[model samples]
Target: VTIIANLELKKQQLVLPKNALREAFRISHAIAEVTNVSSSARQPYVGVSAFAHKAGLHASAIKIDPSLYQHEDPASVGNDMRMLVSDMAGRASIELKSQELGVDLGGDKELIGRIVDRVKEMESRGFTFEAADASFELLVHEEVNGKRPSFFTIEHWLTTVERAEDQSILTKAEVTVTALGKKIICTGIGNGPVNAFDNALRTGLKQLYPELEVLELTDYKVRILEGRLGTGAITRVLVETTDGKGEWNTVGVHENVIAASAMALEDALTFGLLRQGRKPE
Candidate 1:
């Protein structure tokens, strides 16, 4: 009976100070941090997936009326509704996602169709954007503007790992990029090729875009799309970045793990720089 009442209260939000419920999401995360116990992503009201809609049909209905699908307005609980795009998505899903990302489609059905086709083609190649909204937004920008916002252009990058006579593994990287119309070369050493590459890229750009100093890679994940292909399988890498105030994810796909990681890391920093309002050079 007690559990039932609690559930009812949560569902109805009948308490006098209903706005206080806005803290529920933050409080839940705080509890996780304090106890080091993470809640399920499917947890009602607070879960990451609670308000995520994936179906084209759902997106269609949501365009007409969001209340048609969601039990409650996500914002009421300090959460947001997300429209995910995949190969299974349709025009509606792309339209909704574009709007969510602040791109004005202007009801251009032809343009929408093009974006949808591109999304499907990319997903077929193993690039999934559901969890990497930053990458999705970049794609949308490219589609809308005819090109991606660029802060720098890579001329060349090289990473090598070596074992010293003492048996210590050392990874070194050198990156060359053009920013602000001048070529910059930087070198860095790290524990792995990806880490070394990340260090080299950031070091090269730090002088020009000092805002890069605050950006940090918080998490990384890699998946082999086809295990049967063994070492030749396409690799997908997801990189999560934080700017002290917020976090975002980006993704990349390639046959080379290092190349895949570099793609994701590039997107991550590009998104971060864009967020910082630094004009691309």
Candidate 2:
């Protein structure tokens, strides 16, 4: 009887009823739909990954029926599924990608295999497809068409930099380019790598293409890979340029920041030309 006099207090539990839970879900879905509608009206930049996929099984299933792997129809997202072929892929996948590239794969198995192996090896060395470069695409085209750039070659380049307390850092870059059966040397000074290199390159190429002024740099970005403690680690550089007609992105990677930047700039120029239907020499 004395034990019954003592009692323990328990905390009250709060829970949503089934009906209330269902109503909450409906309200959240409605809010998301409204938000998406408003965002679509703003016309924001949508990336390829918005609809791109990489899973092998998913790719196979999508080839059969896109609905099997995708949450929304690619058309709804204004995108499509892309199947990439590499050494990791099967022959079926290779065939599909080859067909997409408009290559006759019926008798080109060896070539296709070689391309796949090359792609795999390059990708392992930090190459990527997230931002597909038309210049690299052109290289693939050339490899398939047996045509490649040979009109011009860089014999050598020399860059000199000087720092002053007051004025901007003076950068003088000189380049020797061989083109049209002749070797030409050009020099220019600018505030940075891009400007200096561009000034020099334009001076050299202007004689070949008088329309050099039409080309303009649109965007530039440098990314550090495995970067820690602000050290200049492996860096990937991207440059976007346009000739008032079309725009393209080109990429380069290197341990040397200046060298990587220079390579990216060159890639941008080369890609810009290719986009205009001009074959790089």
Candidate 3:
């Protein structure tokens, strides 16, 4: 910073530890200016995927030395490396993630083939894994170990928005769950449709998953996708949730905003419970 003292030495003084970016972000969160950091995954320098490794050739090169593909070590910025498993995922990526997540893939060629094919199938249906690492982890654990993670299944649900004589809006939601063939219906009211659905869902899960009480929807974002020939267009919803312990995000793409929001919300809850090693009753 002492440019006047020595112009030639300005570069050395300007060089800063990568943690400086993280410190700035932390300060932003402290004043509530930035509601969520996970929302900025594409931000340069300190994003979750800033130093992420992909499958195939890229993953192979990174194994030899991350310096081949990355400009800097993720740790230099107080961030860790991420290896994403997706439809294009190769065996090398799976092996790397297995090592990181402690999952044993057992070196079976047929099993690895099946895993890759299944990921492709899900992706075809609009399921993405990049930002939802928790869901991906559970999927790998369940498929490789032949045991599914436990979570409640929705039987039926409905949402309604109405106006009273004074033109006040009323939003209501009702959800029913079929757990072990026992049905429980919960109805909740909120200021908006999404809020109403969330209220209903948490109210129903209260008796079963009390830990959900602490969970809150921290942020929500939606974008309209390009229209298809037969289909008009689709909506992509990204939902962030926090339980005081940590934060995670889930994404959903659908033709309807509400449906997309539902998908993200479901993934958020599933990831939250899985992280804590809990199985809903």
Candidate 4:
């Protein structure tokens, strides 16, 4: 569960993630028993569809009463019912999620309607929200209030690779970002391009978010959502981050792995600062 939860908590059953580890150990043990064996795609309680609702007749009944389709209350197992909004899901699902996430859909039904349409279009392109709630939350935030002020904006980043005198490879990176409308630049070196990029980005803003000093990247993952798209296939990046307290997951998707990784990394750092309510120039 540590490995999975570090990346995405929802995948780890019974754990109250991103909030507290109150039941993390017990829940991980229970999850081990369920996941140890070869089980069906639809497991008893933690499977993807264990508490998921489609946008069809079943969803219709769920809207009226959840008990209609759900054999048992998910809350009893420490999991709440959720919906996977796809092309088929009705507006009710999004509205319900808005209530759940506390997004202020308010009186603007048409605005949410547009967001729903946008989600469907993205799903059609193989961009899924099932494992990327951070990205989804950002999307909701953007749709509701437009782009809110971010911690900083990247002016540019550059990387160079060359052979050292001893015939070993050397990668160097330089990054500049604008925080509080002031430009800051820093340079770094790493084993490879991505590593160098990560280093430079962090060094550039260490003064702004000193928490970055304690931050750690526990794990990273990349997936090609659609092979048929070839070079245009969307890449989803999952990054696990921690400040030695607890771990949280952030995700990004793009046509380029580097770009996707950058997005996830940025989100992870941004989330870290937000969690601590820290802001610096």
Candidate 2 has a TM-score of 0.68
Q: Write the per-residue lDDT of candidate 1 for residues 118-167, one digit (tens) a residue.
A: 98999999999898999999988888888998898888999999999999
Model 1 poorest 10 in a row by lDDT = 1-10
Clashes of each: 0, 1, 0, 0
- Candidate 2 ranges with C-alpha deviation above 4 Å: 1-48, 71-107, 165-167, 228-232
What are the lDDT figures for the candidates, one per model?
Answer: 0.87, 0.60, 0.71, 0.70
Instruction: Give the C-alpha lDDT of model 1.
Output: 0.87
10 residues in a row with least lDDT, candidate 4: 1-10
Q: What's the lDDT of the predicted structure labeled candidate 3?
A: 0.71
For candidate 3, what is the total of clashing residue pairs?
Answer: 0
lDDT of 2 by residue, 112-227 (tens): 56666666676576555435444455445655767754446768788888888986588999989887778899998887765787789878977986666688887778888756
Between candidates 2 and 3, the TM-score winner:
3
Against the true structure, what is every candidate's RMSD?
A: 2.3, 13.3, 4.7, 7.5
Cand. 3 TM to true fold: 0.78
Give the Å error, residue 117, model 2: 1.8
Better of 1 and 3 by lDDT: 1
